[model samples]
Target: MSVTPEAAARLRAYLAYFRDLGVHEFYRWSEPAAQALEPAAAVEAPAPSIAAATGVLPPATPPVVAPPLEIDDRELQPAHMLPPSLREPPAPALRSFDDLVPLPATTIPAADRPAALKVIQDEIGDCTRCPLAYGGRRKIVFADGDPNTELMFIGEGPGADEDAQGLPFVGKAGQLLNNMINAMGLKREQVYIANIVKCRPPANRTPEYVEASTCSQFLIKQIDVVQPKVIVALGSTAATYLLGRKQALAGLRGSFHSARGAKVAVTYHPAFLLREPRMKGEAWKDLQMVMRELGLKPPVKQ
Candidate 1:
């Protein structure tokens, strides 16, 4: 019988496997051996059997199932995942409210030296604690004189001159104030001068009720700190701020009022003297009253 090319190749492979199993040659023992192998030889040979008594059987292999390929869906998205270079920086750590140190209270202690002045200064700088803060320049003109002085001159709010210089009594009215101080035989430094409201009203108008109320605390604290034997409230606003009433200046003047437990006397504002220069006589009289109350010498006649 003739063998096809495929059968010849199968026979070669089977022969090679038999050689590896130490079977160099084969001989047919009987007709049954030839008949039994003939069908297998026509097809691919079975793998060698471990036992020679048993016929060779092909090795059974399990079917291999490959894993499905992963396709990234990001390419189809409108927004792409940021590359390492394009990634955002980490946000800064937030500070905890608990971690913040609380600021010390700014309340002025009664009769404390520079501490009281410091409180006044700090309050004056940004004193919105009152409505007056809205209508004036950035700063409130707190008094600038001896904080320890026994005499204090309390005035109304700042005028054009006082506001510009950040000092009390620096205009024509301030000139008059200096004359009045000198006439009473006292230097400006010997007396401490302040205003009811540290800031000036618009167009030198009288301070409003709300503004005066706001600045009242500062004036009271000032009185406590100065511990002055006598206080001269320079105008109606000053009188109102100290006394909490808007009485006529004439009635309020020439009388004693209590301010932070100190003796207070109301008098015309220096600016009022500018408007009514004749009032200087009355102002001088008020200054004499102040001197007499404080045991100071009376003004010498010119």
Candidate 2:
């Protein structure tokens, strides 16, 4: 019959989060007609109605009586209150990159890789295959750097700079990535660069599951063509999609994993290292492991 002001505010915030995730429908949880509340408590402290509380229209069906719940407005837990359809679903088991499809019996020739990649890009032309296409992305930030390089770097997705330039790793993070590349005794032009998702997510937030899964097909093709000796996954998202498994960056890092015939190494993203400078040393260790695998020596100082 009534919701407290504090409870109403919490509900509004929770509903806003769900709405951003594209969950627009909701059902109001109310008591049955048989268990009417006393008039005195209802009148003494009237608050917002259920529909007003969540900013959603009440269901057309008559309110069905559910068992009474004693919820604390201070620490609102609305998921249980929402219907099963509206509740956040459990994370599904992600299919690994190798599992997506069998590797081609033969690799594309180095001379034809650029053309082959172009074909994949052409296939993805003016793509609306995912929600990111309509999310104000200026351009699809596709793969960059040498197509025949022995090494590759895959990041989460484009940011403002990459979105604007239509190239991956072209921002402050990109600058730092260039520095990392130089430190690895390689020029930026000598290795490939790409992302798990080609488009910049709104507000640069991590791409949602649908967005990432939808965009992964192109990335898988890119990796298959490049056939890099080693791939440096620039963050957990990159690692997750490339390896086709969801695990902590800590567990995924410090070891080599294989995907599409490339040895994968997980590390912190340049953007993350910029935020937590202390982690630079740890990231360097991960890179060193890659350098060892690639037989690469750090560039000597002048």
Candidate 3:
């Protein structure tokens, strides 16, 4: 049953009117209608939400972390951990006898005696024990001769001749000493000659105790260095210093005394003999004693 051409046209017009009123498809033109409707459907869908408009929440925040506590490796003990005795103060340091008082300028050991003599010589340059150190153009009156000689001659101090020449016993007294040494059949070089004090005393006044004390260590060091077999203490000062006595020279002389483990013979100083020439014989007798102690024969008179 085909419809007439006019009926077909009338049916097509009804279908198109139905599509315009929101009918999705009319069977006769459904394929073309679907193609046209697709574009409008795609355009009507709401756009995907924008990230900023949606108010997206941030990823969960990590929790706050506390700092690690530091630990000391050492073990802590209580105050009572140490023994009571350990808490007490340390004992005081021990001191020697010499520490109680100041020692002398020259306190050299016996082994170092020679070195000490050199030190003293270097220190006391042109020294005048009293006023002689400054009196004139004086070089230091250093003691000379063998430091280890067996016989030692001790005088009071340097004199005018000794001060000028820088050698001991250089004046008239020195000539007498030379003659005395010759009388013993020995040269001055064979023995050692020194003074109680190295420098000369002013106006040849006797040395005071302070002066003697100041120079005593040097003399002692010399004796210790020489270890002499016989020591001749020439004058009162020498005798007194060596013997530690203030006895009269008349009594102290003509006798031998043990001085620092050596035989010390006392005699009148050559200067004294110069003043009192009458005592020359006595001085000669004293020299005999010195020679006798040393086991040397007296010289024969020519």
Candidate 4:
């Protein structure tokens, strides 16, 4: 049967959902054999006394026939799109950043990194690669700051302010981030910044696994081109995707992780700091670890 465009779109969504759940393969079940008319059909029939008692069996009764079952293709197509909750096995595992894609064969020379990053951006133009494209994202907030910088910051995803401006970190959280950057004795333009997903999730919600995984390819490429000496993962979401594991932020912080040929440090997102200002000290500690690696020191007060 031919699938209409609308139906095909829905099918794609269902498939994406299942793919995120880690169900890559599906198999068709064969139809069950028709049932017998008599309950004793399997019984060794009392020596077939009644029917075979005589060659003259009473006109030989015919076997009952069952009608074919009608199924709706619309409802049954992609029948394996069941929720993971209903399945016996756990959902598919999340892949870490390194597993998402390999680094480019060769590093981009410092002089060419800008143009190299632009190429990746152009490839993602008007992207509809994931559900986020349709989730009311006004603009795609690509990476900001120096392409050749040795330090990069990765956030969860775009927020409303960033989505509207097509630039990362312009809102209140961004302001806090700017302060954090300054505290590290660096200018905003001296460091690169990006997010797990470019497009903003609906209502600024965290990105879903499918959305993050789909959008992160470009991010991986961005990381490769920039080839930062260190990447600071801001928040649990960023850490989850970068390190490719699910762990509490408390544990992930205060230590160095690795991703895409660079050292990774986990910290509280600026947004999180806004909600819990007390944690700013802890976040600063994480940044200090990054600073020490880069040999950076806070600026002297006037």
Cα lDDT tens digits for candidate 1, 1-302: 33444554566566666566566658334776444435334557676558634765567676443333454444344433656554556533322111222223353343567776887688666666766666756456888777777778888778887888889888888888888888878889888998877888887888776676667666666766777778888887677656655689888777687755568877888777889988888888887888888778956687
lDDT of 3 by residue, 202-281 (tens): 77778766666667666665666666788888888888777776778899777788765578888889989889999989
Clashes of each: 0, 1, 2, 1
lDDT of 2 by residue, 62-148 (tens): 644434444435224477776686667888778878998889889999999999999999999999999999899999988899999
Q: Relative to the true structure, how large is the alpha-carbon lDDT of every model?
A: 0.70, 0.86, 0.69, 0.86
Ranking by TM-score: 2, 4, 1, 3
Residue 78 in model 1: shift from native, Å? Answer: 72
Error of 2 at 237 (Å): 0.5
- Using TM-score as the measure, the top candidate is 2
Tens-digit lDDT track of model 4 for 16-76:
6666666677622233211211132333546666557666566766654433344323333
Ranking by lDDT: 2, 4, 1, 3
- Residue 286 in model 4: lDDT: 94
TM-score of each: 0.59, 0.73, 0.58, 0.72
What 10-residue stretch in candidate 2 is worst by lDDT?
Answer: 33-42
Error of 4 at 215 (Å): 0.6
